[model samples]
Target: MKKLAKACLLITAVLFAAPKVHAQISIGVTISANVAPPALPVYVQPACPTDGYLWVPGYWAYDNDSEDYYWVPGVWVAPPTPGYLWTPAYWGYAGGVYGFHAGYWGRHVGFYGGINYGYGYGGVGFGGGAWSGNTFRYNTAVVNVNTTVVHNTYVDKTVIVNNNVTVNNHNSFNGPGGVTAQPRPEEMAAMKEQHVPATSQQQSHERTASQDKSQFASVNHGKPNNAAMNKVGGSHFTPNGQKAPRNNNNNANNNAANNGHQNNDAAKQPNVQQDGHANNNAMKTTDAEKQDQQPAQQQQHVQQQQHNQQQQHVQQQQHNQQQQHSQQQHKQPQQQHKSAPKPHTEQKHEK
Candidate 1:
């Protein structure tokens, strides 16, 4: 009887431990850090790469080796099986530690800690699209789709306006000081359903993100350069919704070279203008000096002409005086001669 009671107790304990172990395995809790994750980065969702692909919103994933958080960029991926929807991973605070809960795929969207991932996540359920029979239809008002490529799309803005979807806040975790939300009834029901772990492609995509330094929150400061991708390995996009160039380094170098050339040209233009201005100023100064000296030159010429005229007048006056003196002397001599001859002739006449 004693052996049987021990055996029963052992069986009960095993039965109780089995579900807890299974729950841990399903949730895939790897690490719990002392710090909280950074806020979710705001970025535009890339267009669905092809039909049947769903949008997996970006999240902050913790890395134990580096002791930092890295952003797993949002991507459009095909489901592991038909009718499976992706429930995004989120950080949750418990027991004074922030724990990471890995995401999985299930028939319905489950609890995502009300993180307001945006792009139709809306903090409650996925309003981006729905599985219609086997073909996934997109809500154009919430998600981006190329109508030319993807034909099964519809516009529904009511999901955004009417629903109490909390999108303004960017809190990254759930608990105190973060998103304080309890899972809704539907979310609780969905959580009990069968779940499939992340596919190999999703795992590889995260691994790739973990290696890139730019995706780390400490380095990027919550703004990662590569925020989204069209597919797992397809085109990368920036935070501003611009496509990330494959040759980003080369493009930057080219831009720098072009800017340098432009700056050199601009610098040269100012120097040329200054030189021309200086030459004009020099010419103006020469003209001004010539204008100032013209009157002095004219005055000196007039003084020289007046001196020559005065000298000519003096010479003429001296010639006139000498001629007058010679005439007077000749006349005096004639008078003397006449007087002496007349005295001698008169004495002869009287006798």
Candidate 2:
């Protein structure tokens, strides 16, 4: 009886120790919760801030102390090594409990509970970008990248059309009410391959997010203020979904202020040119006014000449009338002399 009890005790100890050994071998942390995490928040991915940065989608992480789930914002980060891809974290429901499977870095993307975290994580595999010989190339069709900043890019719309990638659903887990996806053969192989855990920067990012109360699902109602970041410790989203200004360095702030001044000066240049055009228009208006006055001056001179000619004609008419009156007076005196001569002739005839 003693021998049989020893064997049973050995078997029991091995069984109890198996889980710990498996956990140690696993690449990521495992967490279980009684409730499901909130649905994935809808947000636009920040543009790739620089080349060689891979995108990590945002997900809900649980806090045991607060008994609430908090959001870890999506971010861009450099991989631990080249030729590695990120398999995002996800929640899986099994045996009436939700299990959290944390993310990891591997040569190929593994199954992520089929939860569609947008920007190339289309529920099955990562189609957002790929690496070509240590340089990561971004897919502009699904991923947002600043073309001026990131030069390595390509367009593949067929991936979305062929896979029927649905980004509108906000499901946060896999099981009864969430995504119903089974792992493909390739994903299974990827799961068995060697993996690297999240980087230190990624761990710090999650830790910082956990401390912020506003990131909790209970407070934000599944909508976190900082949904995605351009880079770790770089610009992140605000409450309004716009990127908050970078306050990490004073030099950046000064540069932004200087750029603002330059933009203001550039804006003012147009107004100055407009003022110059207005002055030219005023000068042209003055010239037009002078031209108008020239016509008026010529008309006034013509009117003055016509008045003078009328006065001269009136004087000539007066002179002619006075001469005619004098002639009449001289004719009256001649008539009187003829009458006197006729009277003398009549007296001679009577003698």
Go through the candidates in order and give each one's C-alpha lDDT. Answer: 0.74, 0.75
* Candidate 2 lDDT tens digits, 143-248: 8888898999999986683454336588999777988676778987998899999999999888777656556777678887778888887888753459865433
User: Tens digits of per-residue lDDT for model 1 on 27-137?
Assistant: 545556668898877787777878888888888887654567888999999899888898988776654566677888999998888778877888787888898888888
TM-score versus the correct structure, for each prediction:
0.62, 0.61
Count the clashes in each prediction: 0, 0
Stretches > 4 Å off in candidate 1: 1-28, 161-166, 246-351
Model 2 CA deviation exceeding 4 Å by range: 1-29, 161-166, 238-241, 245-351
What TM-score would you give candidate 1 relative to the actual structure? 0.62
Model 2: worst 10 consecutive residues (lDDT sum): 258-267
Q: List the residue pairs that clash in candidate 2.
A: none
lDDT of 2 at 325: 96
